[model samples]
Target: MELTAVHEHVWVIRGAVNMGLVRTQGDGLVAVDTGLDKQAGKTLEKAAKEIGLPLRAIVNTHAHADHFGGNAYLLSRTPVTVYAPEGEAAVIRRPMFEPEYLWQGASPLPQLQNKFLLAQASPVHVEYTPGVPFEVDGTTFLPVALPGHAAAQCGILVHDVCFAADAYFDPPVVDKHGVPYMVDYLATCRSADSLRSVQAAWFVPGHGEPARRPDAVIDYLKQRHEQAFQTVLAACRHPRSLDELLADVCRARNLAPANPGAYVLLRTPIAAYVTAAVGQGRMEIIMDGGKLQFLTIEK
Candidate 1:
């Protein structure tokens, strides 16, 4: 991975997942996030060393394995202090919380325990509050709450640059993942709306190229949420169980989850979408033949 300067002191290593770096006082680098695993951590450390900066600290945007999985490895090499949101701290300190949650709070299946969802345990030295500015070696980074994608995901801002970690995605990403995973569709929409007022010279997303304008990405995200919500409502014309409804949604999107991980990944978000629809009175639940099902509420 190669590190390119985004601003005077901000840099990003773009890959399947982007790792952000902020230059601190005295040639120190604070990683906005470390990528997937020990290998990813090694790559980030090497890239920082190439630029002549010692890795000093890590600010995990969320607890997702892919985003913070490299934390432990990086911490092992350089005893840097780790700062993360209060809500996500437990999951970071105990990697299994992620896969367990995906398994509906039961013991996660072996299929769900992979490094993609369960990262190495990393200590959280500081549990930060959202919208607070924290200082690291005389450089300040503003952590803005961007929930929904993950309940406690955040985007860090510094020097006219916004390191938006999975807050929003480009249109192509939306097109690729038809029913994009999210914890709460409404909260994600709210975060996208919040992005409207942020003026930055550069906006860097965890998944795509840096953009001067965040409008297009935010708009595309909103459109995808609406499309997914409508698809769920339409699929509920007849009373259908969650399983049947999810299958209908998958068929409509031309998606066939081929693995247990992919199945749960899609299932959780579909449930959120259904709950949102039902909460707004656009859909309703009923008991059918001893099975619980959802149906569109006649307007």
Candidate 2:
């Protein structure tokens, strides 16, 4: 585990995915997101020991396994108050857990599979409000709602550095692939644009190194998003179907089809981009025998 101090009270813990620890003015600490599997508990424990503080609160940015899988374990160790996005909180409290909806065909992390399968979805103790201030251990964190990544995803701003959850990707994912999967592609763009306006000393992404300028990441996302849209436009010239579009996207990107789940997740943004273009009169979608086909607008 590695720790990168972004501000006087905030630190980013890097492992399989980045987790955050913030020192409150009073006592205790607030953890944003959790690492993958049981390792997250270990990582948080190590971080707390190193920093010499007790955990006071835990905030889950979303309901992804890697982000929230460690909740059961971490809560078992510390008496912490937990908060999650309202949409995500519903999933966490559902009576019958369904992994297929969230992660189809993907194997659960060894340490967390049982808890996720058997645990009851409980009501959210605390709900998130965009740009609303919440206090933890005497430190106030502004929870800014960032949708598109997930319906109720949020980002945290402590003074200047924004802990931008999974709204943006890093490393092998975005750095290498140059694209990200967002349920609402256009909304994702708007969210990134809003984040870019925040003049912060640093921004800590969910997956990459702490960034000093949000503009760089926003610019990268915009460029890749447009490129992907163009690729979709070009591929749809022949009235290609969704599956066909997926195939072409994978082919053009050199992605393996063996991982259809991953491919679908990655292609979701392309699907959204195409859908958006069609809605805005920039492209046309024709229904042929129950299948939709796309065509770019001329002009």
Candidate 3:
């Protein structure tokens, strides 16, 4: 397991779903986020042993399987308190399973299916709410509320570190058109923007390396998002089918057609973008029978 010190007290285990360990006061340990599968448990255990800290609590940023899949393994072996967003706790504790998070435009993996099934066999007990402050093992944690990405995702604020989950990635992921995923662009921007008030010196992302100066990344993502939103609005001068809009947008940006599932995956965020734009009077949606088409409102 490759453990990198992201901050003074926070260490990141770079694997499938970067796990974090933060040392609290009085030799108490806080497991910020767990990895993707059972193998992640082994890696976390190894890292914990290296630090010689007892794992007292595990705080999940959200309910995504990638961030919480190892819950069963970690909770089973250690007498640890597991915490998650209130909206996600019920789903996590239920022995049944849902898709967890939807992925569009990606190849299906059978291994993921088996892992979800295995995780459903047992549920963890700890849960929490946004903006709520609590203490465990001598350290205080403030759950910063961030919506749009996930309903109840909370970025953790501890000893000069904010574990900013998917709200912001270190090296932003470009879309098929070399554009960033700005579906919830505005909300995500606001979330990161609000983080400016936080006292943290560094921020850790779920999928990428930790960030010291996230201002540039956040700015780029916001700019790309506004550009994408404006582009969609310009193309919607006349009513356009979703497929037509996707094609026009994809072509104007010169995106490739490699994955068949990309279409489905992009729809959720795209629809959200359209919804927000429509609400703001930048665009409007017309429903003909069951078919929905979008048009830009002329200024």
Candidate 4:
């Protein structure tokens, strides 16, 4: 809701989910990722107007509802082209796919159909290419792939500031969530490495304050990632079903999925850890009495 200038032309609208704005030639501006819903989109539009920067385009870093939910509202108010990564474009256009995909291709339960999972549909006019610079009126935004938070998720770089969209979480936020959500554990690590390699004057995370020394943040996230993986590994000392594993991990971490919705959401990142463990040959899947289970690999 507050616009803090990161550079002369680059500003970040600090909110629960940070949105970026880059002033371009003339009165035009490029918005990088909207907030959680139509209300958030309206706030962004008003904020831009207060600063005399009219929106010209929208760049969605990924398809997560919280990141792109404001797209529909913004597009409805102005004629702006939307740019999104290829793999995420479909979900942005068909927001329901998010919950459905999370439910394993089955009809999502009512709890899974909330605004956090399903956003209103919006048109995507451009498919972003990672590691390439996307030129707006007179500014260039370098789209850096930062997947694992979501497939094809990316960060936008402009005016010496990098808008890292959920590639990593703020330390306190990570502690608050207990286990940060990730779809691919290895990819998350790679994204952290990618962020570390970027030479920028400042780095802005989707959910935290912008930092001049992003390495410190990245290092903390790396430690958390390793810890979460180890927690899952220890939870799998004996054969356990996915649900059982999830419960044990949550119990050890003092995390309680208070509702069905929370349970489904928390299941995702834990499942990702299981997938990564199996892929790395540290865990094995077995069938026991018609039940699928995961177990630690015997030495």
RMSD of each: 1.1, 3.7, 3.8, 1.0
After superposition, the stretches of candidate 3 with alpha carbons farther than 4 Å from their true spots are 94-124, 175-183, 254-262
For candidate 3, what is the TM-score? 0.84
User: Global lDDT of each model?
Assistant: 0.88, 0.73, 0.71, 0.89
Among all candidates shown, the one with the greatest lDDT: 4
| Candidate 4, pairs of clashing residues | none
lDDT of 1 by residue, 1-299 (tens): 76778898988998878998888875798998899999989989888877888888998999999999899888888789999987989999999999999998999999998998989999999988888899988888888999999998888888899988888988787778787789998998998788778878898888888889889889888988898888888888988898898899888889898899999999988999988988898998899679989999878
Clashes of each: 0, 3, 4, 0
lDDT of 1: 0.88
TM-score for each predicted model, relative to the true structure = 0.97, 0.87, 0.84, 0.98
What does the lDDT come to for candidate 4?
A: 0.89
Reference-based TM-score, model 1: 0.97
Overlapping backbone residue pairs in candidate 4 total 0
* Candidate 1, superposed: residue stretches over 4 Å from native: none
Report the C-alpha lDDT of model 4 over 196-257, residue by residue, as the tens digit: 88989999999998998678888888898789889888989899899999999888889998
Output the lDDT of residue 40, model 2.
Answer: 77
State residue 197's C-alpha deviation in candidate 1, in Å: 0.8
- The order of the candidates by lDDT, greatest first, is 4, 1, 2, 3
Q: For candidate 4, what's the RMSD?
A: 1.0
| CA error at residue 297 for candidate 2, angstroms | 3.2
